[model samples]
Target: MTTTPGAADWRAANLANWDERVPIHTAGSFYDLPAFVAGRNTLRDFELSEVGDVAGKTLLHLQCHIGLDTLSWSRRGATVTGLDFSAVAVKAANGLAAQVDATTARFVTADVYDAVQALGGQRFDIVYTGFGALCWLGDIARWARTAAALVAEGGFLYLAEYHPVADLLGDDGATVENDYFHRDPIVVDAPGTYADASAPMAATVTVEWRHGIGDVVSALTAAGLRIEFLHEHDHSHFRLPAGKGIPQVYSLRAAKTA
Candidate 1:
């Protein structure tokens, strides 16, 4: 595991890389910005059921890029605040909200570690993070603790993530290319991204950390959240096929049952 001090370099690299991806992601059909502007919610079916009613709830979406999903939550009557480390992404998110004329959604540009101070002492009924988020951070323990701190006393954390098993697979999305149990950073410098593999990328290098379902549960529990339930699924948000009979994604529901 990269120590807190050593992870700074990797985090900076990741931040720069992500900042550059914002415009590309917003332009891509994968995000479907027009659909969002047309009043469509980007969240998947299962997530809605798992998260239950957000009507009149306060929701904080961490690592929310460009606010599509975050605004969707606002449409469901949740007072939403979308947070991301990239300024460009946050700017675009705010722009989308303005374009859609959504009043309940807000965006904040800040790192996951600084979320509390960035949000001005606000807490939420639901602390949400979705697919492709956890791998960017070197510290799951700290990440989970921050999530707990963001949750209101009676609220919970709702997470949907690409399964560790899915991350281990090579580009073919079939052959295993890495260890599932490794709690270490896997430094990568590649050209394409998951959203649009063919799109040219200026920021090619990035660092990713791997965490399994067990790691996720342990971190949340260690941080004082109660284990509610965990379920694995065979589908993913991306267009690529979740390899036959493979569990490609996982959902975790934990609570601050104080």
Candidate 2:
């Protein structure tokens, strides 16, 4: 329930905490299930146009929280599998899939780092990760390798994440605050959770890591995936800071070369 202070301990605690947050997220207003049910695409326009045709493709969505987007891909005719570190998320995802009659989508519970091992030798046509996902990862290079390894030759990896530039600006509601470069693991002692702002959370300390633009690109390239395109935009899914204005999504594409 509570995270310890050390790095290794923090990871486990974070994973456990995320597991608890999944159900809360599923019922939260932020996800807007009614809108999703009304055929709205939760994905950004840049992400949709970049990944393009998923019809008949096998897609893997990593770090899928409750699989709204994963099921959305399945609706577009992609055989989709969603993976998350939280058992609760997987359970919630599976429930939503059955409810929405998205029989083609499956959910798996496993840490991103151990996904390859936990998922056997499954490969996919598209490897997708999205906003707010990378910040939780401590190792960018390893994450990239894991993503690349899961893609079949000619398949590609797509990510639409919060711009690292935006992250440099702290959430202080005023001026730019934090450093852009990857810093020592961020440790926060808080009494509440991000998913359920109103719920009373046990005073728990959590840790997070920051990965810069270069770190993201170089890591993917080093994993033997060729860069297709990288597009940065001007509107994020959520409001970020004041002067930095609203954050935009960065769409990155990396292809596995033969």
The TM-scores, one per candidate, come to 0.94, 0.91
Candidate 2 local lDDT, 166-239, one digit each (tens): 76655553466777764567877665566566755553656778888889999999999999998877674365
Give each model's whole-structure lDDT: 0.87, 0.82
Best by TM-score: 1
TM match of model 2 to true structure: 0.91
- In terms of lDDT, model 1 sits at 0.87
List candidate 1 segments past 4 Å from native.
1-5, 171-173, 237-239
lDDT (tens digit, per residue) of candidate 1 on 1-258: 243346668888888889878888888887888877998878888999999999999999999988888998988989999999999999999999899877988999899989999998899999999888998887899999999999999999999998888777776777887888787677777876777878787788788888878888999999999989999898853644854578888898899986
